[model samples]
Target: MRRPLRILQATALALCLLTTAAPASASAASSPAPSPPSAAEAGPVLAVPADLAAEEVSFRGGGGLAMRGTVLSPAKAPVEGGPGRPGIVLVHGSGAGVSRTKLREEAVAFARQGLSVLIYDKRSEGYSLFRRSYPQLADDALGAVAALRSRPGVDPAGVGIWGFSEGGWVAPIAASRSADIAFVVLVGANGMPPLRQQTWAVAAGLRKAGVSGSLVERAEPAMYRLIADGGLFPEPYHDPGPTLAAVRQPVLGVWGVHDLLTPPAENPPLVARALEKGGNRRYTFHFFPGADHAAHLSPDGGVTRLPELAPGYADLVGSWVRDVTAGRTPVAGTSGPAPVQDSATVPMGPAARWESAPVQLAALVLFAVAFAAYPLVALVRRLRGRSRRPVTRAARLLAATGAAAVLGLFCYLFYVLTTGAKLAAPGPVAAGRPLIWLALQVLAVTCVAATVLTASAWYRSRGSADPARPGERGERVRLGLLLAGGAVFVPWALYWGLLLP
Candidate 1:
């Protein structure tokens, strides 16, 4: 009688806890493009002169939102009715607080070359960490273009757009949609999808910080894909291929030879190919040595940033824009030294439907419940004074280690990614693996071994079990859960690089 009753109570307790556990899971703006000369032959850094006139202005941007900005032009205003100067509207990179001020130095540099420059506050309405509309950003750029073109001192027909970093994606889209934009200037632009670029960037940062092993080779990219599949990453799969193909205007794409964010060696050829595919050949590519992603000075291969723009960067843009806007567009050419890439980009595709967010959440809940049931069932029997078969030491080790390994991997990965890979401080590393990661791998192995020993113990005890004993069935059920958790742990560990070499 007590045997059946104990079975019923344990089953009911498992159901209640299972039900409860299931629901528990929840860019720099500015200096971009072109060089006065090859990096080795580069001349003195051109000083940004302050002899520019900046006027406060406002314009209507995308989504009918009012945007405010400043127009930096020659200190000596153009004579009334005189031929207007060429114009360039600066589109900001991705971020909420990026304002006109952020690009003021670049604008001042452009204005000093006798061009009209418009730098505006990026729209906050339809932009954020998890949300953004590139088309909408392009519209806002067109708005700035219109505002700058309307000024009496600017040449409406000569107006073009300059985009850096995130703006690289937005600028081409704007140029593709608007015939009014005369030429396009991109700095530190990415030709791949946002997800791939991000994954590469994080991995590069990790490597730069002295991290190696599977962290860079495998887990880093895999985690990014998983995050993207869960919809937490904004525009993770946004492809620049079609947008670049649609651009009809002349393009000047530039990158720092030391750029860490975008793959300099890889992007230029891709951008050039895309432009040529669309029957447009007025493109020029340049690389700047000792420059970071933003074309800013970075002496240490893009690991650190300096306030000054790379030598000759602004002068190159000023000259290139003037030439292209004046119908002197280059047929097609690449200049400067070759870029250095420490590693090849990892291929990333969309996660399968079976591996999507909801399914992942369900898996987590199942693993948690199954492993937890062992110790929990033991505690319940002890409190209720219910006699139960003794849980072998192997089964106890399996339950504790399996649960710890899964939870540790999840938490550690989250910490590494959220804090920008190695930037947020990924403890100490030994033999290229973080200390915490090494510990988790050990736990994963322990789980596997414990699973085997626990199974052996269970087999030996099954022969000794009395079906008629009150607590016999309940003890077997608990052991079964621990074994089930171990079964799932092996594949989970392998998937996340735990069991990988």
Candidate 2:
């Protein structure tokens, strides 16, 4: 009973927060760009170098949507009939922006290394917060690849895909489907399912902000599962294992040591193992120090992402692309400083069908009706000039505090999601708990104690009640409803970690 109510509250909270983070836009096509952990977060824009030349172009994406982009190449163009330059198609991680310049830093960096780079606006036709098709996105990426291949200076045989974050997943799918995608590059990629990665990300973000206790250890995991089960988290259960295993292209994986979103230490080994499982031994892994998830400069671990790419990051990509395209595949090995991960990732499979989205929504509706009935009935009796039968003070406290705690928990979690846990400012911390969480826990205990007192009062008065007292039957009815609300409250509180120490 309590589990349903708890999941109900969590599902509601997560749905609202997720919608706010990745709101559905009128445009159907969207790019999965660097958001936080998986993708769909927006990134900062920087100027492309003036020395490089850019060409505006468009191509057909998945479902025949017109995808637009730019091709950046060296100043002295390669002659149309001459040997073409190696090329790369940059895949946006996840976001709504469709400008071709979204990946100016990468395009310019690789172009500077004599590789033509295509950066494009990901389609908006079939993408948003509530829905997306990765295979479709992969098709869109392949479209960009074809466009790059056709460009006068780009070598069709050497064309490849570079995925960052969300793009990491899409790139492999594209590579696996097409032998034309000669190579693959991934930055901040994850080996786990999207749901698991997201669950780990929020917890990691909270822990990085010095948070602990139930919010991180308990509520966060439960909340994410409820969210995914509700179908609000698109592609939450997407397994990248088979996709990576199918990729036969020469692969180069990079991670920033300070990356907070993806588990750097965990993912590389999983990726390497998966690729090796496919009998591909031409993969290389490297780690960059003092960088964030996007390989951007991060002075304070990965809490804040600065606009500038980490030193040697662009150069590494440029040089690696040059070598790999030229058949100089590096020996399969992992290099650079070991990646950092403070905690192991938690598993986040879908919730049981009993705890599915509709059931959770229905449970929430029931809780709302039960809790709201107490005060509404009292107010109506007062308005009708009906003298109310005396009820114990404990009953009133239970009603007030129970409602307040639920509402507060909902709002606080919303704040954490919308503004980010770090920006939500959980206030002072002591004993591994934040002040706000402590207050809610106190309220939860108060509600529980009041329920016991209220029940005791009702039990004592039951036999004393006359069968014909004017409002006795009504008073008993109201008390029963309040008690029922309390029954639901216990499990609800426990589920949200409010009842936990």
Among the numbered candidates, top TM-score falls to: 2
| Model 1 agreement with the true structure over 292-322: per-residue lDDT tens digits | 8888898777878788888898898989988
Candidate 2 residue lDDT tens string, 1-501: 556545654656554554454444454335543222211222332346777887776777777666667778888877768768889999888765556666777688788888898888776656766578899999999888988899887888889899999998999999999999989999999888988887777777777778888988877777667666756578999999899999998999989998888888999989998999998888988899998888888988887888788888888888887788788877799889988899889888788775566665665665566667778888888899984655688887888888778777776775565554223356677777878888888989999999999999989988988879787787778789789888878887787799987
Candidate 1 Cα outliers beyond 4 Å, as residue runs: 1-50, 387-389, 421-424
Best by lDDT: 2
Go through the candidates in order and give each one's C-alpha lDDT. Answer: 0.78, 0.79
lDDT of 1 at 423: 51
Clashes of each: 0, 17
